[model samples]
Target: MTVTDVIDRVSFMDFEPATASFRDDVLAGLSHPIRRIPCKYLYDAAGAALFERICELPEYYPTRTELAMLQRLGPEIAALAGPEAQVVEFGTGDGRKSRLLLNALDRPASYVSIDISRDQLIREAAALALDMPQIEVMAVCGDYTQQTLSLPTVGRRRVGFFPGSTIGNLTPVAATAFLARCANMLPGGAMLVGVDIPKDIAVLEAAYNDSAGVTAAFSLNLLARINRELGGTFDLSGFRHYAYFNEDQSKIEIFLISQREQRAAVAGRFFHFRAGERIHIEDSYKLAPATFQNMARAAGFEPTQVWVDPDGLFSLHWLLAPL
Candidate 1:
């Protein structure tokens, strides 16, 4: 098929959360005693671009490390997945890792990319469809955490891909629930997941608090997004990005700390912040391989294989869902 035909054949499904949803979420989250915001909101167009820069930072090793491991393990993963597979990827990002797997898979039949960022999801899915015309591509824009995924029936076997250690973004309870949902979605198939391994405090902390300040920009961009989209009056300069590895939690906790006592309005609703008060934005939980496997088993996935980097910095797991 021609490139135009490939693009035309690519199905685009948008289930993006509405503007009202964003307003409501912001108003409610800010109303809490300890102000907070969901990390998923940090992926507006600008925030997503900022995150791409974060992947290249020297301190951010997860992206590059995971990419390298996928390069080495692609063929093996493809072998286990077998032929005529339908690959459904969660949080598809820039579609870099999916390309590696699709190229290695034996005549893979279709690819479904589910991401919350609509523009990136459409752009990346269309480009992937154009580049790999033999496979069908479906772009889904929705929050997998909040909604049930409706996958198209095309390929023989469905293989789920969740890469870039994105699973770390969810709490343990949420991660297990999310995996259970994936199991329900891909029964009798398998899931290939990228997970971050707990490491030295310094390394984990540095990954989020990069020296180049891209991560900071990414965190602050959420407020900028609220201002542009929801009539928010947030002084981005008044808050500083803060991230640290919480050893007790085995996670990297990220927040935007108010430099001084201040009040900001989001959706015409005002909230006061005390000096040094933090708005919790994200938590990147680092789970050991065995711990993760146990969680997977609890979620109804049989953990069959796991690959760890030489330095034990990252892990890739192969989980099989019962029929």
Candidate 2:
């Protein structure tokens, strides 16, 4: 083995899209009075880049707030993970929080990065492996919610790392089912998850609808993705971004409102939208520690500990799967 022989330990088990999931979804969603799409689809290369910008916006508190909490608590969380635990992350690969947690772990057996996007997953995992040659890197490019993760046989204890309040994106029933699914993944293991704490409606609203219109652009790109991949003919100018907090549901709602009554064709099917109709893009709920604890318990896990910042706008929890 030469001095340049690095990254040999990195392995990528990728899932390539073979069918038209986007077109089928677009067809299903647009055939409704108020169209809806899953938030998971909003991570094309352009969408992902826009979201990175969304995190840096002044009004976006969750990203920075969670990062700060991780800064102070990563080591303690790692200690609870015990030695040589496998760290598994869901969705896209995050660099900032990844560094903090990876640096804190004590000789973690391997790091498994999973996501729906093959490019982003492979790219980020390869980069991390090249940068930190000591740790084994296994990149699985597939929907973390659906795929049963295949990790190295050497590791016994697994620690699931899911941050950025991604869990907030699911509905109550879906969240419970997803958590139960996660609990199933790591039998007798541990998970570190981030949850956005409930706060004033005003603060939550501003985070999704920023002054700089970055969020707007991010919202519109979803339409562009449909146009590109599904042969859609959506007029970008005819739609505008809308975001608000739903007090009754305690969640953030993001939509693309039709600026004018327009008809658009996607995958050979045309749909008409009224002048003021809205296309639902996302629904994200803020979870109180107690709320999350209840949800975790339903999912077959015991909530072991919770960490919060001074403001209590966000929380990081450590959960243990049934042994």
Candidate 3:
């Protein structure tokens, strides 16, 4: 259970004052005409595990597609990344997929993984440390959106690995700011980013609303998490998972629809929802290649190369600092 760098690693502290406030905000939002909770709050350990299951589901294309792309081109990416590099991954879940690139790196000096969930990060870090004794494993527990991320002070070049297409979780503005933050933390070098390409609305919707019900369970798990964390009472049976593609917006919106009119009190606030009224739980924006390229430019990155899948259902954009 011990990792190679367990002594060098420090435990993470939760400084998300906004976590509670955001919870209250979501409840308030649910009380309105259209209800929704931010999907980011869905990763409270159990939620993270549920998400891992969802990824394994056949209907979930993003995970498999990205993993396949990585497996196919990993050696090339690793070669381009070179050795003596410091690899920093944003949202380092499971850490299995990252090893694909890390292993290909021929043993980079160290690997720094940042995750909001402390336990998961520590567990993965320990396991990875044991597996790859040559690479230093440093785990930071904090929201990557805004955190003072710590990394090795010395390395040839700091290369950022942002796989999983998780950047789609952010709105365009948030994505811009996020990329800028990552760039600031990384010394001038390159950023290997995975971006999910825009596709047909039907295909996009189907991916989120899988037939196996795993996605639904994932969407509704938020309420279960609320009950566990905030002492809120939510009848899981009372809500239905709803996901649909907003063609104009080019995003898949997942909602928890009230199966029947219900009332709940959270943090001394009374919230009401009519039958069929939906709480917008999550939004995964599908990015057009041009649009995401422009986003990277705004964040001070130039798109040097893009790896698209055979069917072109997704894309991996390799953005680098200006020459």
Candidate 2 lDDT by residue in tens digits, 1-323: 22123235567675744438777777888887678987878888788788889999999998899888888886788779888878888865456687688888888777888777655666677778877777788877676656766456546688888899899998989889988888888888999999998898888999998999999999999999989888889999999999988888899999999999899999888898989899999988988999999999999999989988899799998999976
CA deviation > 4 Å runs, candidate 2: 1-9
Instruction: Give the better candidate number (1 or 3) by lDDT.
Output: 1
Off by over 4 Å in 3: 2-34
Candidate 3 residue lDDT tens string, 1-323: 45334645533344543557666766666666656666668777887887889889877788888888888988788777776788888888888778888877856888888887666778888778778877776777777887866555546778888877888888889999999877677756678988888887777878888888888888788888777776677899999898888778878777888899888766656677789877877778888778888999899887777888998988888777653
Residue 78 of model 3 has an lDDT of 75
lDDT of each: 0.92, 0.83, 0.78
The deviation in Å at residue 271 for candidate 2 is 0.9
lDDT of candidate model 1 versus the reference = 0.92
Q: Please give the range of 10 consecutive residues that has the lowest summed lDDT in model 1.
A: 1-10
Q: After superposition on all CA atoms, what RMSD does each candidate show versus the true structure? A: 2.0, 2.7, 2.4
Write down the TM-score for model 1: 0.97
lDDT (Cα, tens digit) per residue for candidate 1, span 263-286: 998887889999999999999999
Q: Which candidate, 1 or 2, has the higher TM-score?
A: 1
- Colliding residue pairs in candidate 1: none
Ranking 1 against 2 by lDDT, winner: 1
